[model samples]
Target: MHPDQSPLRARSAPRHVPPLLLDIDQMLDEFSRQAVRAEFRFDPDTPAVVTVEFLAERGPGVIWRIGRQLLHRGLTEMSGFSDVRMWPTLSGERPSSWLLLETQEMEALFELPTAELAEWLDATYRIIPDETELDGLDWDGFLLGLTGGPGVPGE
Candidate 1:
């Protein structure tokens, strides 16, 4: 969410990473918590794909389309790796996505950063272990860890 060029303008289609595709819920959750704890960081190749549309004519429409995609698809896109994937938002909150790997994960991928995003992560993310651990910790990562996907960025 780098805003050096722009201000309050974040309207884009959310990245699509299927949730059921992986089951590393706990790890992802903690990861997100750490990120939120750290604040939202920006990167060139972030797991979460963001779209920013701030116009009057087609703004509402694009927002709807992108927002829906973000909420539905983006929400689950990072389900296993990026902490953002584990974000908490209303179920089926299409047009408004949730979950994304925390700043830590983003930084792991991209090093260049600003202090503002870090503060954002610190304010938003919070860890919750008791709730999601029962689901077996989303084994998608272990198998994928071998493949070199989100489970392992540069394997």
Candidate 2:
């Protein structure tokens, strides 16, 4: 293994919070019920959507994790959207248009406010996807972070 690339030497999460992230703390307090949906897409321009709804309020935090595993299996087992690079986009301060294209699941859930379409295209997510089930999917983690708001846990 390279001296610079060891698992034990991995960088840590930033102590300073980023400015772009929505007030996740507020969302956690506003509501307990929550869910996440996924979508798969075949077309580079558009793709199929897949979703796995979850109930964080009904049980401990594990339900969300289980649902995530379910989503992974569901995408691998199904066909339709390409499962190439799915959720890695959200890590970016500003995701690429190419990244946004794969988010059929999120788009299905929440339409970009018509007013915000141009801005949404230009900046970061001041707004996010609603909630809807999609089919097939690429294996990207970008969509996973969208699981904030009413469903996700918080400070």
Candidate 3:
């Protein structure tokens, strides 16, 4: 019996698994391919309804819409992919917190409460092995100085 194929050994053995790092480019690709959808709240107080659609082909990389208005057009690529950061609050939290999406040029702040961010991530990205792999990363300091805190940009 091959050691690698041995059932007993496989059951008891633990393989050295590499940490799952967030690859923004790949994530965007998956996001486009899957046609993922999520709500972007520009204003937390008023609960502004903003729609985010990831596009694989056709027009700009993303479509931002509020009611019948189009805010941005022709976003070829997410500039400064390495600099985006996300900060999610504890599960089952009220009114939801925020997921800080920051870039060198601008930031997209969303009020994603509790499992909303997690659900969005699961829907948009192809997680390897399992979703739990994502828990290893530090979302609070995802991009360091680019962000202010977990809930919002300033607070």
RMSD to true structure for each model, in Å: 19.3, 18.0, 16.7
Measured with C-alpha atoms, the lDDT of residue 19 in candidate 1 is 20
> If the candidates were sorted by their TM-score against the true structure, best first, what order would they fall in?
3, 1, 2
lDDT tens string, model 2, 43-152?
A: 21121222212223445321111122222322223212442222221224442211112333532211111222223212211211222223234334335447543434
Q: What is the TM-score of each candidate against the true structure?
A: 0.17, 0.15, 0.26
**95: Cα error in model 2, Å:** 19
Best by lDDT: 3
Please report, in order, the local distance difference test score of every candidate based on alpha carbons: 0.30, 0.25, 0.36
- Give lDDT tens digits, candidate 1, residues 1-155: 58563543455323232121111111233345222121122222322222322223323411101122232333334334433333334444232223333464242211112223223222222221222323544468777886677748664
Evaluated at residue 123, the lDDT of candidate 2 is 27
Task: After superposing candidate 2 on the true structure, give the runs of residues whose Cα lies further than 4 Å from its correct spot.
Answer: 1-10, 14-66, 78-155
* lDDT value, candidate 3, whole model: 0.36
